[model samples]
Target: MSDTLKHLLHPKFLHMTLFGFSAGIPYFLIFSSLSLWLDQVGVEKSAITYFSWAALGYSFKYLWSPLVDRLPIPYLTRKMGQRRAWLLCIQLLIMVAISLMAMTDPASSVSALTQMALAVTLLGFSAATQDILIDAWRIEASTDKDIAMLSSVYTVGYRLGMLTSGAGALYIAAYLGTSMDQYNYFAWKISYLSMAATMLIGIGTTLWIKEPKKAAALVHQTSDYLAVVGVFIICVTVLILSYQLTADFFQSFRNQLFAWSQNRPLSATLTTASQLLLALCLATITARLVATTRWVNTDMIKDVYWSPVKDLFLRHRQHIWLLVGIICLYRISDIVMGVTANLFYQFKGFDLDEIASIVKTFGLFMTIGGGILGGFLVVRYGIMRIMIIAAVLSAATNLLFMMMVNMEKSLVFLTFMISADNLSQGMALTAFVGFLSLLVNRQFTAVQYAMFSSVMTLFPKILGGYSGGMVEQMGYANFYLMTAVIGIPVVLMLLYARKNQVFEFDQQSDQKTSPH
Candidate 1:
């Protein structure tokens, strides 16, 4: 085995793998599983879709990332490093949130159930925080050359968690219930408790691992606390002011803009531009206010909380852009198709049993296989090449589902499509994660990677929200085909990126140009 592969197979890699599993398992429990629970209780699809907005907490994790990066729990910070301390705490929160979700039923009165929804939202936010810490640890603990191997291991663990929470939880629920029509409260509670137990494994692993020693200068001091509070106040003030300003501005201008554009059709571009401007204004005001608060002056908070984001961006512009593009395109096809898969299965007249057996069970294994294959390929061939191949294969896999759209829904064909789609998704996801790790600076790994992964999720979720309408309009066959075609622009972008040697050249250039 190559040195990288050998290192990946080491015990530390296994530790990271378990950590990834702990992080991944609770996600679907709060997301898809919870959606099902709500649906079973007769929650409207519109309400369920709104619940998905709870997931926006994940996308905005960067907001609190600096805390994970800087603030250390008193004894925990001393016992464990920033990353581990943050990971363990957030994992604990996730456990609590999941258990609470299991205890409550959304079918109860809206006033009573609002707390339950909040609990699930908390779970998502906590999980997102844990993800930030994990991403930081993964990058900090590994070397550039070993990142691919580490990434693959992490992906394997992550996918396993997704599979268990999705299919495994469903099976458990199905088996425990007396009838399919009755609610499986006990089963769901056990499954959620099981998820909590699995997270403890991560806590144990964290305890066993040695904390990364902080440099003396980097250690937190009293001033850090004051700075943190100051920054917090400034950030809050700016957000409130910006919201008021924008709301007032929009309300004032709405009629005028509508009148001017009466004859002019509103394109997606115009809509996006309007939203973008509002968001940019809010973000800018918030950041500027935070900077003015002077929270960065103290030693404890200086490096931890108020370090210069602008400097990093300027220093790593090319890599940052590449990271953005990779994140945006990594699972474009998979995410787009995911929004329509169940409907497609139903449209084909496949019953729940067939769908569960083929797509959920068999399909999950194929995904694991693809992740492992992609990881191995990265170790063997390098990340860039693996990324190229995985992207192309992912695009191609969409066609398999399209072909099945009009077919007789044979078991063999279902198996074939599931295998192709899942395997390719696994490969692409692994490569994409490895690439993300490479882009992060170890000093700000959690915050930077959180930003990247958040962006990775944001666009997909926004686009996916409309997927049901699209499928309803175009029908399943054409929808799948269109999903496949969506991959084309991303593939072309990847090709252009590779040909330009974006990351490679940027790294070399940074080294040569740095003021040592």
Candidate 2:
């Protein structure tokens, strides 16, 4: 092997790979796995919609990102360095939270399970924090040319994690030899415990890894303690003000808000007073923190206190526009089709058992294959070409479902449709992630990626919410055909974006302007 390839295969690279695995595994445990468990337990479809909202945690992770970016664990911060210390802490929490979730039963007491959902939410938050650090470490550890290979390694580990959570868990349930309902819940608990165990591997890898050197300038910038405090205070105040304004709208229109909030208590007087108190306290503390901590000798503190929000907007205008467009169009067809697929199966007379076994189990492997394949393709060909091809394939595969919808109810046709869809989805997801990774400035990886992912999710998820009503309005054949048609606009946009060479031009301009 070339020395560069040999270096990448060394123990340190393996460590990062395993750590990536640990971070990726629990995500589906709280998401897709939980969805299956809920479906099996006979949760109402409408209630299941609320459960899906729990996924909003992944999308909104940017809210606490500044905290993760800034705060230190009293002694560990100095011992392990900022990034590794934070990563280790969050991994431990994820381990503990998953074990806690294993002990709760969703059917017996949903309120208790809701508490478990909160614990899972905590896991998602911590996992996201770990991802922020890992992405930074990956960038710093590799040379520019090695980035594609490193990304592929990370993708392989991530897909392996997903396989364990999705298909592995299902197989365990199937083999347990219990009633279908009991086996489903038992399988979930076991899967969570297994996920917890996976963290140990990451922890061991982290211990052996060396910390990257801190930049001298970054250290100098954070020495101002008062500035750090001032920035923290202002950020907190803005968050509080935003929340209070939202609360006021809810209170003023209690009936509408209550419906959405599921009738959590709301009164105008209390809402007004609460908002005022929160705003004042937040503003006061923020002012004090920024003033006191502006001179701390840390990059962490500077990032927290600085005006990144404004800077990103002004500096990378074209890139930002590309980010917005990619986010909006990436999964438009897949999500829209997904929202109605279960109903389609039901209409075609497939039992729940058959649907779960075929789509959730076998189809998952197809997705894994596609992810691994796309990763290799990205390494072999560049990200730009892989992205264009993936988009085209994703759009084309929607037609497979349209074809299946016209065929008579046959398991063979169903399998074909599921396999094709999953393959396209996996390939598209791999490319999308790579593209997003390239766009992020490692300094702001978590927040920028979060913004991209959140916008990507919001529109499709909203459209998905109306899917059932649409299926009711239009029959199955028409619905699938409509989904196929939806992919055309995004595919065209991708082709145009590629032909114009937007990202390439931006990179050239950036390199020209940068100081040598």
Candidate 3:
């Protein structure tokens, strides 16, 4: 047998694929599938868009990842080691959140939708936490040479998980709920309940797997744990107080802004931007304040937070800000339009099952193929080159959606659009993931990876939250055009990075650190 095929069948990669699936499942359940459910129950597009913010936990998961990194769970940590113990507990929380969501009927009332949103948000937090642990494990478990292969395997697993949650969930709902016109809460409930059962695959994997050597003996000082806990409490208190004090002012300001501009999307965007800035500023100040406390240990803070970040800046200090900008905006075009994709398909005359079969099932296979191709190209050529090409393809594919908007509602046309979009998305994501894996210093795997992953999604998700409003104000054609235009900056950034030798710097850093 070929070495590549032999490695592909290795138990290590097999475990990673399952972890990827576990991570992928809850993500689409919260974002893609939940959007469909909300729309099915007659929720307004604007409200459905806002619900996307429930997963903002992903964009800020770094704030809490330190605890996951250093602190040990009471009983669980003793049994399964740090990473696996955390994994099992988190998977349980995910199952509970999914079950709770299944019990709540969004079609019943506004309050019920609110309940469902909260449940989804809870699920999002658990899922994001799982991602942190899994990412850390993937990094720590592999050599530098094999990391890309591992990442590819993980992506394949993640896409498979997305398939289950996306197509599988939809099929179950369609099967149980025969009629499309009427609200059938039971059908949706059963679908979610089935998804919750799939968590067993993850939980079982957690039990069966061994912790990475690096994560197994992660002994930290007592003060480190207490300091993280203390700062967390401080940040939460400050955030809540800041919001309470400014809520009404922002509301009035938002109303006046909306009334004056008569642009719902712009007004909402500005309001959300202001609120996020204020909250982040307040949290930073509070965390800084706690840093100087007598009980707090500066060394602990430096090791946990500062060192990982410092390492990155030290490696690419010249292009750090540019690198950050690239990370933040690289996927903006895809995410902004992606949130409203199912809504668009429904409006264009496709039913649930057709969407499930074409968009979810068939499209996902295209995505996995693209991801595999991307991984191969990155190895054969280079990460930055592949990433640049991926960026162009990802942005350019949005135009396909615009064309679909004007075309007849034929299944063939829809399949073509979905195939192109999903393929581009898969390629872009694989390259991006490979690039990030290279950026991480294995010493601070969890925290560094979390920060990079978080930054990449933060801005895109913020813009995505406004997609529905954008589609409402502007027509589908214009919205897609805007999404496509959003890719211009990313392409430009990649070109600039290529010229500035950013990838060269990364290569030098890796060589210096590599054992060989």
Model 3 lowest lDDT segment of ten: 505-514
Clashes of 3: 0
Per-residue CA lDDT of model 1 for 199-265, tens digit only, reads 7877887777766553112356546655665665566466445645565556446555657765222
lDDT of 2: 0.63
Off by over 4 Å in 1: 2-9, 178-186, 213-308, 315-323, 339-356, 407-409, 472-474, 505-516
> Candidate 1 at 364: error in angstroms?
2.4
- Candidate 1 residue 439 Cα shift, in angstroms, is 1.8
Candidate 2: segments with Cα more than 4 A from true spot: 1-8, 177-187, 214-311, 335-365, 402-411, 442-454, 461-486, 505-516
How far in Å is the alpha carbon of 380 misplaced in model 3?
1.7
Task: For candidate 3, report its TM-score.
Answer: 0.92
| Clashing pairs in model 1, backbone N/Cα/C closer than 3 A | none
Q: Name every residue pair that clashes in candidate 3.
A: none
